[model samples]
Target: MRLLCLDLEVEDKGGFFAYPSDFVELDCSHKPINQISTIVGSSNGLLCLTHRYRNDSQYQYLYVLWNPSIHKAIFLPVPDFRLNSNRHYALSHGFGYDPTTDDYKLVRVVYVDGTVPPQVEMYTLRSGGWGYLTASGPANVIADWTLSVFMNGVVHWLAQTPNGEGNIRNVIVVFDIGHEEFDEMPVPKSLEGMEHLNMEVAVFHGLLALVPCNGNEWELEGEESYSIWVMREYEVVESWTKRFDIDVGVGLRRVVGFTKNGEVLVIKGGKLLSYEPSSQEIFNPHIRSRTESFYFSTYVESLVLLNVEDGE
Candidate 1:
């Protein structure tokens, strides 16, 4: 897993380091924050970042399209949404590239305190603007901590929908970049009724992989395990298969994402560890951090957005 390491030490200037062998510092000196608040997603060597800051009474968010390889970036304009200080708001985003149109699109979903339907918008890099989409988002509740994963030109998220008894159940919400439409996919039957299960989405071997992180939050120490479910066929309910069940012994604070080579990246004892599914062996890369949590994604260096106009 290529890491984008952020230094959280107060004594030094906060910056990012692309890790493993080469300690190269990707420049963010052009922006005021000089640090990326959130990495939404990356595709074709282009990264989508969000920066949030408070302005007097309310928080303002700025979206950026950056290509570190060429050190070029474009800051997108703010959306047409009102931010009332009294009302609570949660924002979720997904970024991907559309090969059909040769465009990079960023999706934003705004949920207001779980009372109103989510407002969905799409921002295309070529057009350089945000447009409200007809799809208001899934007719279900998106899990608060679920991160969006882009695979096969569709963005996926874990959501909750009400069942017959007015009970909430877990489901998958997907949005196509080409069609610009939203659709629903089914989780494994074993996981459908398990609404309390801590689940996450990932891509494995060119297929959608759903990981159920057992005992991540609700289980006792030394009993945490991860079960991977891979959808062999796209959009097919029955193709879900149980791939691996890894028992990570102890001190597992959280399950990070997966590596490009199919190794699972996990956190144990404030250090980064990689677990190879085939060998079932745990290897520590010796990445230690003082920060309590980490934000990471699989990355590749590319020249995307290098030729685009830099709207600074």
Candidate 2:
């Protein structure tokens, strides 16, 4: 697995993250230079990043599709809507590769007035521009920090449905990039009727899963519990199963992703750790990162984009 982190300085420079046992300052010489950006998602060795700026107090946003393994990138042209008088900036984005078209695409939804439905847009790599999509969008709030998980040419995010005046029920919002369509799927039944729960979509064994945060169990004492519900069959709610219940001597806040050998990696109190369920041994991967300064996610290194350039 790989990770991305910011350089200690303000300049947008840092190295590729490789987890080591000892806690040491990671080196940055190997990473490509970048702007301070939030990672919207990553797939097929491609990373989607968005950087927001203010020029004379006017909002400016830039989107980039980068291949860290290739150390190359392509800057996306601004969507037409954002350039209009309305300035319909995107509130969330999803990225995926469409095998059917042999292309990469981005899906974003812009927030307008609360009463106004979100304006959806689709960005195709070959097209190099964003076009409006009329696909169904979230009915209620979508957590801003929920980075989408791309799998099987689909992007998924944790979303919600309004239950009452101010309450909501959790659900998963799916976007089929190849088809340019949107759909909603039921979350694990265990998560149903949960108003105070927080969750995120994660890729588990190449399938979609929900990482439900057991925040109440997280503390300095007692055995803490962590759970993930894996969808054995895509788009089938009945197939959702609790694949694992991790009991750790220490507390953990999140299960971001998994490692190559199936070790579950988690973050708690700002440190990255790995738990081998078979051995029940937790070890520090020491993925040196300064949380306050950088955005990060796990990835697998590849030379895909370079091959694309070579073919071109």
Candidate 3:
């Protein structure tokens, strides 16, 4: 299996400020045919990527690439789409290859100039055309910028709803791919104070898992606080159970991905921690380096680890 980490630098005025780099390329048996941007592991051990390039205006394009074997990467151009200067914007969110359909899909949450409605554009790899997915919620629910998580052939994202007076409620929006329908998923009871924490969602072991960071409290005390909630069954909004709660004294972070053996790998401060849900045992790899981003695959492969120094 092969894994890769990408370091992205965003420029500011006099100097450059470093943000968290995007995680790309998961562990897989298939070797990439060429160096392609936005590589992601598709279901059934396939490597999917797009030839993405940035223009002077900062827009991006998606060109599909595949490596049937380890030696070469094949670039496939969709019929209707052109690689010209079309102001195409590329997003890593909500883009993955679905094994069931054997098609790559690209979903982006964007805003149009004349409309107040938030729009979701979907592009299928096989058809090479764009379709609009209907969305339901307040105008501001979809974040102007946020990542989209795909689970069970559906895409999920966090949105906001304006309550009475001036308050707002954070809700989960789900889009079903098969039916092309939109629905809402109830957040876990434990997600009460989600606005105050850094949270993310992923599918683990045929279940949905939520990870939340402890924020300034953990930063000041040098402690880590995180929890993992697993969905007991599919499509049952409230069927979630807390699997594990991690409290590593000051300097540890939660694992962002799973190991080939199904162990949940977390990082604390600068160390790696693994938790096996079946055994409820936590193991430390003791790697004394800070990791910026991580991705996992179903097999063991050399992981693309990243380390960054303070920018000047």
> Highest TM-score: which candidate?
1
What's model 1's lDDT at 162?
37
Q: Where does candidate 2 have its weakest 10-residue lDDT segment?
A: 21-30
Better of 2 and 3 by TM-score: 2
lDDT of 1 by residue, 145-214 (tens): 5677899899998777734447667788888999998888998887786647566677766788876443
lDDT per residue (tens digit) for residues 74-112 in model 3: 344332323244443323345555566766565555444
Q: What TM-score would every model get versus the actual structure?
A: 0.83, 0.77, 0.60
Give RMSD to native, each candidate: 3.8, 5.1, 10.0
After TM-score superposition, what is the CA distance of residue 227 in candidate 3 from its true location, in Å? 1.0
- List candidate 1 segments past 4 Å from native: 1-22, 32-36, 56-59, 162-165, 212-225, 250-254, 259-262, 289-300
Query: Per-residue alpha-carbon lDDT of model 2 for 1-312, expressed as tens digits?
Result: 555433233345544445433223433333323444666777667777676667664666677776766677666777776544455333778888888877888887766643225678888876667788866666655565556788887888887764344656777877888778877789877676576655678888778888744335445222212566889998889999888766555546667567668787776656666788778888875553433223445667766456443111
lDDT score of residue 239 within candidate 1: 97
- Model 3 TM-score is 0.60
Best by lDDT: 1
Please list the residue runs of candidate 2 whose C-alpha ends up more than 4 Å from where it truly belongs after superposition. Answer: 1-10, 20-36, 54-60, 83-90, 113-116, 163-167, 213-225, 247-253, 290-312
**lDDT rank order:** 1, 2, 3
In model 3, the Cα lDDT at residue 172 comes to 67
